[model samples]
Target: MERLQKVIAQAGVASRRKAEELITQGRVSVNGEVVTELGTKVTPRKDKVEVDGVPIDREEPVYFMLYKPTGVISSVKDDKGRKVVTDFIDSEQRLFPVGRLDYDTSGLLLLTNDGEFANQLMHPKYKVGKMYIAKVKGIPTRESLRQLERGIMLEDGKTAPARVKFVSGNKSQGTSIIEITIHEGKNRQVRRMFEAIGHPVLKLKREMYGFLNLKGLNSGEARELRPHEVKQLREIVEKNKCN
Candidate 1:
């Protein structure tokens, strides 16, 4: 027997933290009885689960890295029938994105049914850095660079200090290439950062997240993570478990 959230995660409903949310919201049922407490546990072989009225059960976990493309939403389903990240990967098991990539942006994204793994990576306390290559309008002045590096003021709050560099650019093209690395995962943050400084992003691609990168992968391609990579990720989570 395991904690209800753990069992729900093992079933690939969502991350463990998300599973807790579902439980508290009364979306989870075990053996026809609603369970709203995190301390609830069950024997998978004897108990049944229903999340949002759909039967759920434990299955072999799956993990993959997808090079998400523009026009594809980072969701399990879209009400408007738009293309989603799952459409790029063919798998029988249910998987959810660890984090999100905006519809207009493209690059490395992690998909998995392991809720604990997703929670560890996505939790802000870990301070995982995400790097992006952005093409934007005009060259950012030294003042603007300082603003970004020092922590730009956003509606939510001041952003954390970030790393920024000018990759290449010229006024003739009316665009410039710059790379920025940030720890915060605000919605459309890279684009909003540039737009905040009067330079709007023309294109954006995530280059790296923590140790994950897009190497030898084309747009819309999905590949399972290697055993060593999974081990390394678990180590990261365990190392920071106390913090």
Candidate 2:
């Protein structure tokens, strides 16, 4: 038997967090009995489950890679009247983002209902590297690059050292595209780091997350992950356990 939330998530009914909310609201039932407890357990293959009076069936796992566009919030909901990331998803089954990309930033974002998988991706200790291509307002000097390599102090505190490199760009135009790789997922980290150095980021795009990339997928388009791709991703997460 697995946790009810896990069962619900595996069935693609909703995210584990949202499944818990459904349970709390008395919307979920197991074996024809309403269950509202957070820690309730049930067998997905044996027990019957339903949400909002609609029966849920076991479904094959689904994984997607989306090339998120800017001006959309990463969250499932926004209080200030803004479009959410879900608006871009047109799947028949329910799915949610594994992690997040800020509203102004864009690029590869994964969506899946596998709670265990999502846990591995979002857990801070994993140290899985994410690469970003950033265009900033000014060209960073060699010394500035050194400071970024060592790490920079944000409002929260000194950030972990990141891999920063200068790519080909026009210096006279006061703009440069630099590649940055960081394992930590702080709020607006790339932009914040550049701002700390007086070179604010003009545009940001996540080129890759761990082993996943946005290759071939057009902006605002999404595609299901191939079986081998999913297997490789799971292996990557397992090999790099979050400490």
Candidate 3:
């Protein structure tokens, strides 16, 4: 017998942490009875497990990298009928975005049916850096850029120090392009960071997540991750786990 949440995660219904929430919320059931305890365990072969009254089938995991387009939601489903990241890929397994990009933000996004892998990569303790390029409303001076590099205060709290690079600026247009790398995953963080420094982002695109990038794919396109790439990702997170 294995932990119920583990089985649920392996079945790709949700991440292990999310499975725990579903269990505690009384949304999971084992053998026709609702399970609310986190410690519940069962045999995947004998016990009939269900999430939201739907039986889950354990399918082999799949991973894909999407050059997500703007105006698309980074989710499996959107309540308002918006296009989602999963809609860009054709797959037999139920896949979900690793973390999230805002509805208007576009660029490299990872999707997978491996809940455990997704959970590990998204965990704050891993400290995976995401790099983004943004066109802001005003040119940021060296001191303002340095303030971002040294860490700045936001409504949520003070952000961690970031790697900020000034790309270019158009004095006449009153705009500048800046590249920044950050480890935090706060909602609308990139936009907020610039806004706090008096230069709100007018356009933004995520260029990298860890070492992954949108090399050959165009917007709205996706490709399966190579086995070696997946192995490298696992190694990266595992190595971080040891530190």
Candidate 4:
């Protein structure tokens, strides 16, 4: 037996926090009885759990790594008829992107039906690094790039310290390519960070998430994550918790 919110989250109904809200709002029921208690525990195998009157099945979790192309939405569905990341995969289980990539940004995206797994990875405290290869306008000086390494202030707030490296540059063309790794999931963060340094991003593509990369996959292609890969990701999250 486990906490009701945890069970709901593990079943991919919602994140544990959202599950708690659903419980308090009287939207979650256990065996035909409305259960509004926060810490209620029930046998998941025996108890019938429903959210918003719809019973949730404890399906086996599925994970996929997709080479998300630029112009694809990192979502299960889109309202404006735009192509979504999930459209590239074939899966019966309801899968959602663990975290979102901007509609115009591309590369390494993960889709999964495990809410608990998704929550842990997406949580700010986890510190899972996401690396991006960005081609920006003007070449930034080392001093300017050091600001990013030391955490620069943004409109939202000061950003966390990031790992920035100069990959290549074209002094004649006034363009440069840099690799940046950040753990935060702020909206358009990579682009904004470069813009703040007076080097607006001309192109951006995520190169890695934690240790996972788009090693063999082509753009718009996807593959199931091996069991060990999933375990390694969980281990990374756990190690961060210890720190």
Pick by lDDT: 2 or 4, better one: 4
lDDT of 4 by residue, 128-179 (tens): 9999999999889999999999998999999999999999999899999999
TM-score of each: 0.91, 0.80, 0.94, 0.96
Pitting candidate 1 against candidate 4, the one with the higher lDDT is 4
Clashes of each: 0, 0, 0, 0
Where does candidate 3 stray beyond 4 Å? none
Clashing pairs in 3: none
lDDT score at residue 209, model 2, on the 0-100 scale = 86
Regions of model 2 farther than 4 Å from truth: 13-40, 48-57, 76-82
lDDT of 4 at 94: 87
TM-score ranking from best candidate downward: 4, 3, 1, 2
lDDT of 3 by residue, 1-243 (tens): 999999998888899999999999999999999999999999998999999999988889899999999999999999999999999999988999999999999999999988988888888678788999999998899999999999889999988899999999999999999999998888899899999999999999999989999999999999999999999889889888999
Clashes of 4: 0
lDDT of 1: 0.88
Kindly give the stretch of ten consecutive residues in candidate 3 with the minimal lDDT sum. 120-129
What Cα-based lDDT does every candidate model obtain? 0.88, 0.84, 0.93, 0.93
Better of 1 and 3 by lDDT: 3
Model 4 stretches with alpha carbons more than 4 Å out: none
